[model samples]
Target chain A: MSDDARDEETVTVAHGGGTGRTRDFLEDSVVPRFGGDADGLAVGLDALDDGAVHEVGDRSVVVTTDSHVVSPLSFPGGDIGRLAVSGTVNDLAVMGATEPLSLTCSLVVEEGVSVGLLEDVLDSMQAACEAAGCAVTTGDTKVMGSGDVDGVVINTTGVGVLPQGAHVPDAGLSPGDKLVVSGPVGDHGITLLAEREGFDIEGDLTSDVAPVNDLVAAALDAGTVTAMTDPTRGGLSTALNEMARKADVGALVDETAVPVRDSVAATGELLGIDPFDVANEGTVVFGVDAATADAVVDALRATPLGAEAAVVGEAVTEHTGRVVLDTGFGRRYLSEPEGEQLPRIC
Target chain B: MSDDARDEETVTVAHGGGTGRTRDFLEDSVVPRFGGDADGLAVGLDALDDGAVHEVGDRSVVVTTDSHVVSPLSFPGGDIGRLAVSGTVNDLAVMGATEPLSLTCSLVVEEGVSVGLLEDVLDSMQAACEAAGCAVTTGDTKVMGSGDVDGVVINTTGVGVLPQGAHVPDAGLSPGDKLVVSGPVGDHGITLLAEREGFDIEGDLTSDVAPVNDLVAAALDAGTVTAMTDPTRGGLSTALNEMARKADVGALVDETAVPVRDSVAATGELLGIDPFDVANEGTVVFGVDAATADAVVDALRATPLGAEAAVVGEAVTEHTGRVVLDTGFGRRYLSEPEGEQLPRIC
Candidate 1:
């Protein structure tokens, strides 16, 4: 490309929109230099899984990192601190590491932010760590000049251990596998969008931001979890699509079976956003054995966080690498989200 | 504090200056909630050391995190990518983990950043990883709306391994320990300050930014490393004071012995900055047993990166928790840096 064209090649929100665009950027620029995987790593960048599982003395150590720049810092139900901790912990949980060994937090705060607000955020983070049975063992802090950053951006890295043969990848799904979702979807994204845009919806539209490792542990104890991933940036549609493409299998979802809170659905309708395409922090989609599907659902439903658990889909051989959504009246393909639906919704 | 007074409490650049103000913030706001150490951690947040050492079975796993937000992106000798990787890697190295097992990177880019520039940065990061003999196993990328963030901010977390009793802490110095500096001081801070301020110096002023794990490993092999810390943010003065205060000993320094490049010395004089009070990214200050101090210096000098290695000081019991400088004519106390010598020097 010429200089003019290259200069015009600026990044858009879509590049980080957790869709095909994001995947394209990674595969083109990052994967080539960094490579997909390295020696002694069970799940490296190539898999694009929730975490990287490093092999050490016949044991698997999972490591993952995420940077959170959610707007407003404080939301209706949760704030950036809570979101930062839960996002990392949930990533580890989905990678079959239910209990994180430790976590490292790095905070980049813009000048002029109130210390009181920072304290509140730190308190929320500590509370979340306690809830997840983990702690922030080490952290780094940096301050930038005014206007260099908005509020604060937090980056967290988590480390955990998984049994040798128990390593789970998002691409481990089979054609006969059943899929289940732990509780309602879209609550986190819809609530944040409403709160940011000042929708003033009637019902309570609190964010479902939480760490779901406890619920995942319960599910694992009940049945076999073949593949798992948390619906985050691109929501359920993008997550299911990724699993299908990576596993080379098709996903058939019963639209009516996917749980959605009444308030979230109404708010999403008001905003013209599909709940399935919105983000969720405290939800997980698990691919399980057909024989243990109901058992997993029962196990999830037994917990408070998973009270709304349901069997939403199944892996199939037909329509490989596609997600088929059955809307009761008809069936259509669920395409991955294209661009930024709501940026900084994490 | 009242609401108005609390609201007036805003974070300034000094809070992140790596000086007394930074120490106060960590102790008052962060350390209280996060605590100083935990059960399995050998050195936790409270010590304010280089990294956290988590005891896993009979071995120690060192983990550290750092976020880089240097302006101009590309500088004389290095860029943010190399700085981010080297910063995290050195943290682990100073904690007695010379070989990093893996690293995780998180990038937060503002809209309008050029893709080519990003590719260049990633290439630099890969090169730094290769130099340090490590690889990035996993990473995340997020883009914020324009005006929400500056050009780009990179956060990296490194994990490494050490033996059961080989963990090093910045506070492990004793009364009779000797201090060794690997190379010249203030190269990184002075070079960036001059570059950012558009100063045309006569001599070459390249940043001494590098991964000095090999140099540190060599020093360790030649002597008993009682304590170690990198003079990153507040230069040699702050690091020595921290060691003295934490270990309850006094540091006596020979002012003429510390190494300072001629270009750096001239630039520091022009900028009204003291070389001892500025940052150095590619250097290390070691507290070693007095018996093997010469051997440690010899080992460090044998390495290409540590030709200027010198024994600059020693720990003494006379004036506990202080640093005294002997100028060959008179002796005076060297106070810790107050605040914000040069913002974003890293």
Candidate 2:
């Protein structure tokens, strides 16, 4: 009945912020209806992980879906097409399914969009799939009357296969595990925000929207990745808090070691935003055994996409379900974002 | 270069009509990019079939995705929620994958929609999934600023499995194959149109929107189904034309044999729309071996969802790639509906 109480209220933008409010909405409104764990599922809606792992006969089938409603359609470094494909692929990658067996795309377009735009989007999608070593095998397209939808909203679903019992969960971390990041965070969210607001930052503010499955596969090959997740909507801070809470551990981040582009940091400071609380399209966070953390970072750095990899933090025994930031001056608790500071960024 | 010629043109409602225009756009823009056949695909984008069949190791994986942007979200018999789930389920069922292994949902909602409305819609989706014996294992949610989206648009992707070589393609029909229909057509399209236009027809004008996977499975078990497709967008005419063209054969239909509800026929006449050219959410068309056509019809009729199943036509040796209808008084070619006469009907 408590869940039903929220039904009377209208949806707020913060409900989809990908932070505490988002989780609260999901737990109250969605989880009760169909999010409970189901049989044949290694990872179901209850886990709220990157993707769901279904145990088929001798194969672990990973499935994930994302709806990209990014504003501006085209951005600094990538467009909606690349973001859509990479989002689903990364979700699968984080679940230990680096090779996508199949991908499906569904497009909802507003009337009057130029065919040239659609073609460009499709080309971007094709190129991204090729980079991921996959293809769009099935798709559906619907056109709404003008203003019924934004310029375009894309939904992509990815299916991948991993060896049985090989899939990873975001909640698999244990105390004393080292936290590793594939690259600089907040590039995507900050770039899109700057572009939308017409802010001209000096340094490179391009979005880091690329497929990171290859980077993930290399890391998985090098070390024991107890847990993995992409810092997407709510950025590194939200992802770290989720991992800590789900694993019943705490995280202590060395702020100096976390990768951040100078331009991104400057823009965040100017805009009164935290780089850690934004989004990164082509980045991954790993909870790895302390002994193999350096090896995992080295393996990631070997890849073009993960050249800026670093060990940013560690899972700790104290302050379970919290994230503590060591800014090198003093330690402070890093809170999960309460609402979306920048919506429609991805 | 010819494909690029259309790039300069703006997208019209006809571009997404699920008819000749839609096929042309796909061939010109999409096919050139990624619709070509790929390795390890039993049924790929080129086929434009119900779904794509990926040869995964030893098992055949069937994947399909659909975006539901039906206007007036709730209709006479079903809402967008049921339509979304049933649409994906039927697509997989037509491909010989009646048992869905996983389903993913992605929702794009306007900022001010009521949570109560979403709850009702989710309840409908849950019931539909339960009917299809599937679960929503993974999903994503995004909220747009008010007016960026109409209300809520749902995209659902279904992943299913059949034994390798067991899946069917829409182009598998042959000469002498019997054509069968699950039940009366035109209900969904006519009902939606009536609701949109505020026409108070004096009869049961309900949309036949239900998951028909069980009926399809029973029919497949009873007879040899060489080809199959569900009539969702351009209705039975478009589906039959596609089957004939893909198989490089002709079809001869007995107009009287096609089942259309009396009220639907009356409504179609009132609106100057052909019943055969309107959509039916829960109806299926089958190309069966003539020897087993009677048994297949019987099996379908035994199910509550297919009590009106009937043999409507047969593939013929003449008039290659065309469909001819015998009206008892005369005969004429049945053309694919040129554009969506009713936009956003599905």
Candidate 3:
């Protein structure tokens, strides 16, 4: 079978990229396959949240674990160390949790890996943890021979507490819920791409790799947030599609309303890729009840991270499990993304 | 530096195999480094249990996550699927947990990986989970290109509840505490080695890949068990060294008391490897208080999995942080195991 045909049948390497294809593949193939009652489990397969929260008792705790095997350990936007900490902390934040306490880091370092490099990564991780108000309480280091492992792979696990009665679900969408973008999408993916491919770009589109818990708290306090998610791998479109499916609703999106930086657009066009599918390290897609949607948008706009926030879509009871885009001329169906657009770009 | 010197300084690809050199390296290097600090939150690294448990609230939870990457996917003794599930479950079992409730499997599959292979592995994993009485509740699957990934790497994360008031510490060693082994050691490592390297070994030394939680419970119920650990990765010497360090005690083991199968011993002798450091998937090393050690041993011996249980040593305060061997001829020092000692054999 041809590459494209095979890609459709099976997840391609590109699907591993934090791009549209990856997002689509996950929504179409993965989530539905693992059929289960997600009621109190804090499922994010649909919503694209940072981590997940399962209600255990009166207090809900946020739990998230991520493995990082990004090549060129150090990158222009952020290193694997920064990615590990930020990625985990963001998962807690999107769950409307404050102050993540303990973090565990497991390192699989290949023999012949430079001690200097390991120290550098650890230092970066330490700094990131300190900034996020978490401690690296436990860790495991295993050394594999040269061929048995890549240079280094770091798996980080995190735990945070969620407030009572503030439990947010990815399916928090209501009929009039407004969709808000924390900021422009595709910056992190694009930045990493530029570094990996040696692509020169004019603008300073640094990765927006910051903890969004505080920002999430602000939005939650502003009014009722129907849903919250971080558009990491598989980007904004994947997150929206998941929300729609989970809430048993449809989304009507205005393509123009979504924020896209000029540089990001140009880069996407040049690479023949869609920016909507590219992952963002520091971005959130939240759905708010229509009555409080305006206040939510204003609250987001007031924060530095959410200054460019916009109301991109509204939830509709019709077309459940579908997301439609109104592109001025006509309405076009936005299918779930599939496969990797930029493999290993995470 | 010469290859030999380099191997001494850092692990190499050969260390993962079940060769004489692999055993020697582990015996000389790894074990001594993390042998101490068995009490409280600090579990001595030497035990090489699937994971370490920390007391939180009134309960202690066994937390362990293992990344499985075995070549050929399937083998005579066990497949990657069974290994992933059994490995984590055994880790919890060694910690004296009854049933492991939830397990999360993360797959890093390469492009071109067959759907049939994936399904088979999953089926094996499911069966193992059912046998172990656990649920595969959550997971993440990421596909990378052929060159970017090995065929498939499975990482299983498990959490199990430790019975209240049933606390086991690494440092609970007293001079008279008896040492007991769940069963014969080195079968798993040797079997994997023979299969991978096409070694023509005759005797039936199948991988002892069975869960030993029942045996653990029997032993604990019969007596006051000071500490327990599964002899994975670095094997028995590694486990014992960790125990000694934690209890701030020393151990003088009778070399003849340690059980090794005829085939395992013959193979180790032929390969010039120390069987003590070879990995065993199903074995558990328990440090029991003197007064109840015999009862614990008798209870263990009642089970098929623990028929070969033996009291190998006594804890000593004089030789703190050290494991000594009474070879009948004289007293000799026993150091902790090091390096891979048959890396990836698990």
Candidate 4:
């Protein structure tokens, strides 16, 4: 076996540290496993989206599950509970599901964890659930010894029902398909990093963690949306690359068109990381067919969550499996992400 | 707020460290939170089973989600993938749901993880899904930098349908209800600890991480079951106490009647932990009405998974909210679990 393969057999602490290597592992190891069955049992391996969907009883259901192990538990942008609820709900919403109901929450809380804090987190979760139009139906709480855990780690699973005939065009991208982002990216990652590093940024720089179902619904209703994805862990770059590879197409993005918050850009510069590969909890990239691109953009703008929607690029047939950026200098080259940039932003 | 409240706000590593103090948190803090409407939501705070069931369109659905952050992702009994799938499915089954349709899985993998190893885990997960008669409908994969995690953590959410009027009792313990355990307890916890400690109880101890739906179905078919639970974290003692408290009744268990593998008992003694509080992966405690107790035991015995099933205890009105053990020496007293013994064994 190759050294790389040998290394895969053993697990290290760095994998959970939420750094760049995490992205690389997903691209190299995890993605290819689902080889081309976009609607099969293991179809999620093909699309780098927030969650997966399954067709049951003539209805497609969107299902997503997430676990939060953030050390501080509470952060500037959000806490573990908020992240847990928002992250999973967003996954379902991005898939165009409505009336998301019921969440199964399993909490692994350390012994001696304060009851007040747990109640506070639960309150936050309840609020999040209500905001997302869901309820916490069942949950399991296990308390370990004081040294057994950091604080509390929450794992949540959610189920949402997709509208009938809501066939989310998974890979209909052509050379002229427009790439539209619902809003700015990288705020969640940057905010998390800032909180961890004890750095302060202007404009609150809070996590842009919100449910995006309305934005997705508006976009879909406007016309034919070729594809949709939440730019989460690996940010826009990873998301675009996965889309291109899955659709067997190429994408040409103008770096200038992608929205980047000033705080996030500055934070990225200071940390020597590229914001393109950072994580965004609430951002989504929608690939729209050229004929209805304008209508889709307008519809997205109508939603409060999609006020900043902008067309960033076009899908291409050339340079298949490649994502190219049209730099202002007029150079054309592959925009391959250098490394796993943000490991644990999610 | 006092110092105790302040302490509650922060979670220390000890909570997840698999130790005694962890038990204290569950008994003292987490258990008291289930105080609300009981009948409106089946299996709500009252029973404290894996997931909650809600009435939906003439069908009751059981939903469950869990995260697998067990250190040494790959263990003798199972890996993170198998654990993730089985844990979620068992949660649904314990709620008396049948034929779980689909499971949604999300992975947070660290960078530098081997693709081949991930494939193994995925394959194992697929096999597990098949065993449980469920499909892997959706999933997400996120790779973080190596430092952010140990290797990979998996979060899975499952959805299942419960037959109409199949009142799967969460907690309705009345005096004279018989407590029937499906099989041996503490094997999974002892096996995990033994492996983690580099001891050699290998062959004799393997995690009993099988889906318990079939066993549950048998018990339900046998007759009316007053209460049912899977003795997982905090083991039998913790599970019984919770049931007793919820039912406003007490339990008297015969120590000698409780089934325990000799190997697990030896390991527990060596580690200074009680077998009662040790974690269990695949054991169910069924409280059946006294009239149908013999029939339930007979039904369980006919099944391969419950060959060793036995009546371990009975519920009582005296000493409500407490569990007592009837020792062979003819003494009966409260049997409270001391602390979080063997934390995070689940």
- DockQ each candidate and list the results: 0.77, 0.81, 0.24, 0.31
Off by over 4 Å in 2: A1-7, B1-7
Give the candidate order by descending DockQ.
2, 1, 4, 3
lDDT of 3 by residue, B1-346 (tens): 4545543464454544333344443344333322334334333234444455644455555566776766667776678888888877777676677576456666777787765566667778877776676655555666656655657777776656565546465567787788878788888777777777777378465788766667777888889888887777667777777778767888888988888988888877776667787778778888888889889889999987899898888887788978899888998887755544455665
Task: Name the lDDT value of residue B5 in candidate 1.
Answer: 75
Query: TM-score of model 1's chain A, to 2 decimals?
Result: 0.98
Model 2 interface root-mean-square deviation: 1.1
Pairing residues by index, what is the TM-score of model 4?
0.83
- Looking at model 2, give its docking quality level: high
lDDT string, candidate 1, B28-142, tens digits: 8888887755678787788788988888777788889999988879889999999999999999999999999889989899999998889889999999999998888888989
Total clashing pairs for each candidate: 2, 0, 22, 49
lDDT of 2 by residue, A212-275 (tens): 9999999999999999999998899999999999999999999999999899999988888888
State the lDDT at B259 in candidate 1: 95
Better of 2 and 3 by lDDT: 2
- Winning candidate number (DockQ): 2
| Lowest-sum lDDT 10-residue window in model 2 chain B | B1-10
Tens-place lDDT per residue, model 2, B122-225, is 99999999999999998988999998999999999999988999998999899999999999999999998888888847857999999999999999999999
- Candidate 4 C-alpha lDDT tens digits along B234-262: 67877888788778898889989999988
